[model samples]
Target chain A: MTASRENSSSFRNHTLTVLAIVLLFLFLWWADGSMAEDLGLSFLPEGLNGYEVQILNLVAVYGILAISLNIIYGFTGMFSLGHAGFMAIGAYVSALCVLTPDQKEMMWIIDEILPSLAALHTPFWFSVILGGLVATVFALLIGIPVLRLGGDYLGIATLGFSEIIRVLIVNATPITNGSLGIKGIPCHTDLFTSFIWLLVVVFCTVRLLSSNFGNVLKAVRDDEIAAQVMGINVFHTKLFSFCLGAFLAGVGGALLGNLLTTIDPKMFTFLLTYNILMIVVAGGLGSISGSIIGSVIITVLLEWLRVVEEPLNLGFVEIPGIPGMRMVVFSVCLLVIILYRREGIMGMREITWDGIAAFLSRFGRKKENRA
Target chain B: MSLELFLQHFFNALTLGSLYGLIAIGYTMVYGILRLINFAHGDILMLGAYFVFYGTTLFCLPWPVAVVVAILGSAGLGVLMDKIAYRPLRDAPRISALISAIAVSFFLESLAVVVFTGLPRPVHQPEWLVSIITIGGARLMPLTLLVPGVTAILVAALLYVVYHTKPGLAMQAISKDIETTRMLGVSVDKIIALAFAIGSALAAASGIMWALRYPQINPYMGVFPGFKAFIAAVFGGIGSIQGAVIGGLMLGFIEIMAVAFFPELSGYRDAFAFILLVVVLLVKPTGLFGEKQKEKI
Candidate 1:
């Protein structure tokens, strides 16, 4: 009886913890609303402006993307460079779905099936879900044949897939409007929506990581041969993670498309995938919190570099005209980061409550011990 | 399409194929020796073209001198990259080295962007090489003739080096077993560095010729060709230099003919490569020229 009581108490604690997380997320969402008023703060020395907010939104979206990629790349040990392709699929599909019939007419082949989709013109939220589903379907198609190949071969295959997707989008003028790009997307993404979506992704991902399935996935990453011997179904695990990763990427892309209010084939290039890969590597692969921290750091650093390129003359020593200097600096930093922190900043460790407690105790050992 | 047009594109395809073959050789050689993809190889090619561009336009050097300078400069950069990024991680897992290679590639590309800006610069073709020659009722540029000749020479030289030289024997030994080669007192570092130098030199030569044909240079110019060349290397069997050359030429021919036959699918040119890669992977993971290796548990 006593043991049963104890089990119930621990279960209650778990419930409370979940509640607390939900409350914190709600509070953050509310805070975002108030922060919207200070959009101009981005422009001022210490203020954040609308543009900055938008950039932050982009970072949040990319954070979700990087985390999802980490699931496949870090956990499953699958080297996929085609995350951008999945994202593009989601973005274009979602954009196609959410846009009004008139808007569709302007962009895609609307005359044939306009009557059917016109009635079911779903909301932005539904379109986002639909987009994720579309991306998942595409992932399944690509993953089935390609996932069988291991290591560098898989990487090359995925990279090729990304290029194919890009070129297909460029050529499919009837549907994608070709390289001219799809424009006039309704601006539905903002801090509140992005923050909400970020929370859901984080929560779902955390839940997934804590589940038994996560252990099997990690096992595959650690040693594929051993994992296979243990009857873990390595291929299925990889495919699942790959599909989920692609799905999250799709959702992120949907949000990004909505935020930018425009979609271009060039925007979803291999460089974008490389940027995300850099973030994942810098943050520490296989660490979810690391992806979030890394995304914020990289996005902020990229934005701040604009200041370096400003036409500020430092009296006698004038800065020369360096057009793409930021990318140069960014790449140098990436190289340094890879050299020094090959395991990344967090080294596959997450920021848990125990870590927080240990950090707090360093400053006040006596008081923390008493507590 | 007219017979004349077909003949013209065929020559164009051959020129492009040979250039790809040159670059693909570098990829195949590095992969053969180190089993590393050396993703930065494409950027090295970009650097080579830029070197030539600067040599001719800024320093007023003749085209041949510029080409020589570009090749040497590229070879030096290749050695430096191997020493800095790859050598330390040689003992680590293959994936770690690959990631580092990718990072290095990105760093080089970004650095190029900073140095040369994102704007496209026109590559100046030498006056003598700019003229078109008529053959079999088809117009052919001097570059068309030069590319195949250079490719043939380079392939022969590479074959001879791999088969006849002491260093080639050492490379073959290392590729078979690194520890055994080291036990034999072969300087692994020097041999590896030499491989990189040769690979980079080939890439540089390819880049110069590519620029001559395309007449444009950009920081990101190498990305597509780099990928395609890598595909060519894979298609021909990654560790086989002869295979790489064949793979590259075949890829080039397929791409051009695909575009020529189906203009509607022209935009799907990149897609064609991916599909080919996927099909090859599904049917034969070891690639066309790749030897089957037993997997050890």
Candidate 2:
């Protein structure tokens, strides 16, 4: 009887959680459309430009990317600097797949379009999934050879792969449009779409992390040899984590490309990967919620930090913007974080409901005492 | 290839190899002691070049004096970077140091961008180094000969210091076992600083030579060469100095010869070194000259 009661309560809790999330999402969807004034007041302030909204969307995308990276680098103990490359594959593939033939014709002015790819077109959702799949395939191919090498060697090899991928994208003129890049990708990404994708990705990641496979992954991360002795196939587990990370990275890339309405070889440089690395490291390596929080903080701060990179005007004085100052500040922050707060803001802990409830109760007791 | 073309490619490869080798020594030396890839080593090379540029133009120093200034400045910066960015993290996880190194790299590059502006400054070549010299049927610049000659001397000097000197023995011991070296009476920090100083001095020499060869200086210029030199160092063996030179030379030859033979593949030239790196990692992770040590389980 107690078991049945516990099961029903658990079901009720799940339903309540789902209802709360759905309500939140519904509010966002409505605010995004007809309730622009309300959104401007509550979600974002009035007088904010389109660029701010775009930055907000990027935070969602980066959240998903960071969590995915956490699976490989955090949970699986593989240091990969190739997230940008996978994202590039996703970006290029999705962009190419979704662009109209007319748009392709306009964009590929530097070289003739490959006849096979010219006529190809898929819907936005399909293109995104296809991009993820393509990235997964590439990850598998690259992973087979380089995954055995641990630590810094893996980092360099993956970095090399990303560079090679970038080179290929630049040189394969017929397919990627060379340096001109593809423009006019349909903008299908927005707050709601990206939030939904982030939810799905985070849900999947959480489920995967809680599963037996996730345990195996953490085992390998803590000690590969010990995990192997415990009968885990270390290689296969790592490969799985890598492919999953690549898949989500691809999806994030697709969202970024569609939102920006352009895809370019230059967009997927090591600098892009570096930014993601900063997010992962700052978010606390192994925490899922930390990834989300880190993504939001870093992405917004990066955009906000543009103030330093732009000229400031006062009533009586003007201070010219110093280029690269934004990055200088960012690197300093990263250095500080690495040196002092290496475990990051969240460490390996997640934000739990019980912790929140206990804090609320404690606040209520404090008010009672004051009274 | 004709004899003239062959010789031309050979000399070009030698010059390129020497620069790569010189830069790789910095990487290998740091990696040897710390097991950390000094990503900022490339930016140090850039700073070295910039130091020389300013010394000559802004300060009106002679070229030789400017070179000395560049080397000293680079060495000081290298030691400072170690003390500030890396020394604190000596007891931290290796990944932290790697990240710190990357941060240093970004910091230096961004600092350069702010101070030097984004424009690529034209390096004024000393007239003595710019004159074309002929060897048999091949024509070359005198700097080409000087680069390899300087590289050889530097490598020999480095080898002597590493093998015959007391600090050199300390470096070898630290690389083998850091804690044990610390347990011994050696000042680990000083030895590490010395490694940084020597490595940066070599990097400065290469950077000056590279500027002489290329004649243009930009804040972001050292990135590609730095990566390629790291690849060269790895190909030779991370801890082996001689291996770095051989690997640098081989990479230089492959890069030049591949482009020379098939001009169309020039677009893929940058990819070549990375491909070589991946292959080397896969086939021989220890590299050609690297001694394989059993992992202490």
B1-297, model 2: which lDDT tens digit per residue? 899989999999999998999999999999988999999999999999999999999999998899999999999999999999999999888888998888888889888998998799999987888788889889988988989999999999999999999999999999999999999989999999999999999998999999999999999888889999999999999999999999999999999999999999999999999999999988998889998978778
**Tens digits of per-residue lDDT for model 2, A341-369:** 98888988877555665688999999999
RMSD of each: 3.5, 2.3
| lDDT for A362 (candidate 2) | 100
- Residues A60-163, candidate 1: write the lDDT tens digits: 88888889889989878999999889889888887877788887675664223345554446789998988898889989999999999988889989988887
Best by DockQ: 2
Per-residue CA lDDT of model 1 for B20-97, tens digit only, reads 899998888888888899899999989999999999889999878988999999999999999999998888778878
State which candidate has the highest lDDT: 2
Could you tell me the C-alpha RMSD of candidate 2 in Å? 2.3
| CA deviation > 4 Å runs, candidate 1 | A1-48, A107-120, A358-363, A366-371, B1-3
Local error of candidate 1 at residue A81 (angstroms): 0.3
Model 1 C-alpha RMSD vs. true structure (Å) is 3.5
DockQ in order? 0.73, 0.84
